[model samples]
Target: MNNYNLNHLKELESEAIYVLREVASQFQNPAILFSGGKDSIILTHLALKAFYPAKIPFPLVHIDTGHNFPETIKFRDDIVDRLGARLIVGSVQNTINDGKVREESGRDASRNALQTVTLLDAIEENKIDCAIGGARRDEEKSRAKERFFSHRDEFGQWNPKHQRAELWNLFNGRMNSGEHFRAFPISNWTEMDVWQYILSEGIDVPSLYIAHNREVVWRNNTWLPYSDLIKLRPEEEIVEKLVRFRTLGDITITGAIESGADSLTKVVVEVASSRQTERGNRSDDKRSETSMEDRKRLGYF
Candidate 1:
């Protein structure tokens, strides 16, 4: 007797594809919350594979914080153009201008938390009943509380205890009017799984993930890229270093780590042995132990 079974990566891929198809079948309007990061890129790739021979049914929606790395924006546009996919961008700056939110001020200032309002507004404006994302439970404690299909109330609030139960690959997307769902196809994947799959599948990620020389400064225990949003104290000097980001977000809040893993194989190997979670470098999450959970309650992806 010959035994045939899917490998570990294939199992994760199958689960993600199943979740994507379920989102399509369960919701009237759906979208992918693309951030030009590796996770979102992988989500888009899996979505493409899920409905091959036909264009992805839903559009890609990005909540632009107006503080992104230039390389990220370029990569986002190039991939969208290549896929001929519809792109909708909700600007945080615009939201700030409209008095919907205020930009944080001071030396530790960042617009990272402000993304919640913009994301919520975007959801309502687009009438998106379900927003598909690439968040993984292994990323953080708050994220660990997430279900495959997370429901948001009419005001876009998430109550973890009140979320519907998911069992045996069965998802319940039932919700009242004015409510929506946040579907995570890759909810169970870990950082290691993502990198290994990316390597195996030959998926292209932004150049920021590869080690390269860039101007950075030490801040909040990590190397932060020099950008207009940051204020350098007199003692802080901008120095060049070979670094790579494990996660991508607004340049103001996202931090990079010194690394020599310039290739995908090296990245996967590095990830396998690393002790810190990828988001450990992010300054926003350091604000509080529950910072991510707090943001989630306010509709931040």
Candidate 2:
């Protein structure tokens, strides 16, 4: 090892920047999946730093489940406007109307699973061969098996067992026609790494991550954000609670935790000693032991 001081966060940033550039050089049409989440915000920040004088070469693709938080959508639009990056939205509701995927039924109904169809459709419609996502290995068990350059079949399905070997920083993005890649620049970064980077870089994330008073309902062992999309069960009455979301997604499925960490400093402390995974509140993953894997196989990011 070199005798110089080692800064892990800076090292991670450098690696992510290198991966972003690699995607730019390798793919014909590449886009970043931006959701105004902390991870994607970091991706955007790095992309800005990577190619400073030039505008971001790729567009930002958002797959609208139609259940997104109002704050998230507003932040997304604001960032795209500020950065002058092109935005592409693929609507799950449109996919449903087109008879591609149907909405779920019963009390456990959610549009979370239907997002895969919209994502695949968006990739096909936009002719995007490479999609840069803000997926971290520490976020989920299934994601822990991902590569920096993850391969997808012609149908956009992922076979986790059959991944390309990224040895010594040499990434192989070779794919046949109709095939594409899901490249994760920060796959190696942990939750703490992201928090530290955000704090250090002073990046802005959506307001949901910070603790605030919101009307929520207790469901499926977690606090569900109150929204028009969430049908209030007779017994499930909405109550005001001070909560924050660990992960952001469809209002019906994404779960929130009771927190008092209002600032970034408090958030760092909260994340440091947290016993559960960052995605522990995501009810979509609670469907089964291999739910994430199953979704990934079906082309869910």
Candidate 3:
């Protein structure tokens, strides 16, 4: 039984590695979107395994929202240094300063939605034909519509209706000039599968995922961390709590959950018994039922 479970992970790993290799072979200018999130971390690890003994041919791209957790940034830099890989950062702050995107207003304002413009800008600026992302189909409804090679139109908009069919394990990276593809190497991976694989491989993840004491405020039915970017409501009060983030994004919108799972093994156990999805804490998705799908159409990742 243990061997069977191990082989399941090996199969997923093989599929991800094959997809990464396909991206390298098919695209002239391909880059992996590295957000320092667990999914992206796993993607980077698979890319390394896919091209062992040779330096990864593609660069790592980050769409910096200027609102990320400091630990995420630190982890990103450390990983890049360890890998000896090139990193390209697209700043959402720069996009705002350049009048390309406007920041939202009020206490609920977040830079989460503004990352799309920066991502598109980076892809165009870098001439990236294929942008490999760590998005998984099980994470959200919009992501479920994605193929192994998700196509983006000339304007970087995703039209689910126009997506090409992937028969068998075959993928078509062909696209017209001015258009590009958003490839998801681990599209079929589930949250449990990711955690199990991480444990099996002994991969390191950001510490924010582990339970710790932090000052947070109750907002939007989740524990919103106290950050300078967040505007405190008149009724809201800051209080320290044992919390951990399931998904990391702009700190303003990424909420934490009360947890006692301080270690990876405990985290895996917690995930198994939890009823809510990992993304349940993310406030951005709470805006609407189709919020993620809407964003994808507008070129948001």
For residues 1-301, write the lDDT of model 1, one tens digit per residue: 6788899999999999999999999999999999999999999999999999899999999999999999999999999998999999999999999998888888898899888899999999999999999999999999998999999999899997777878899999998999999999999899999999999999999989999999999988999999887789988999999999999988988999999999999999889888888999998999988989988998888
CA lDDT of every candidate: 0.93, 0.91, 0.93
Better of 1 and 2 by TM-score: 1
Model 3, residue pairs in steric clash = none
Cα TM-score per model: 0.99, 0.97, 0.97
Q: How far is candidate 3 from the true structure (C-alpha RMSD, Å)?
A: 1.9
Residue-level lDDT tens digits of model 2 in 78-163: 99999999999999999999998888999888999899889999999999999999999987889988999999999999988877
Superposed model 2: Cα runs more than 4 Å off? 1-3
**lDDT score for residue 295 of model 1:** 88
The CA lDDT at 184 in model 1 is 97
What lDDT score goes with residue 127 in model 1? 98
Looking at model 2, residue 265 earns an lDDT score of: 89
TM-score of 3: 0.97
Q: What is the lDDT of residue 20 in candidate 1?
A: 96
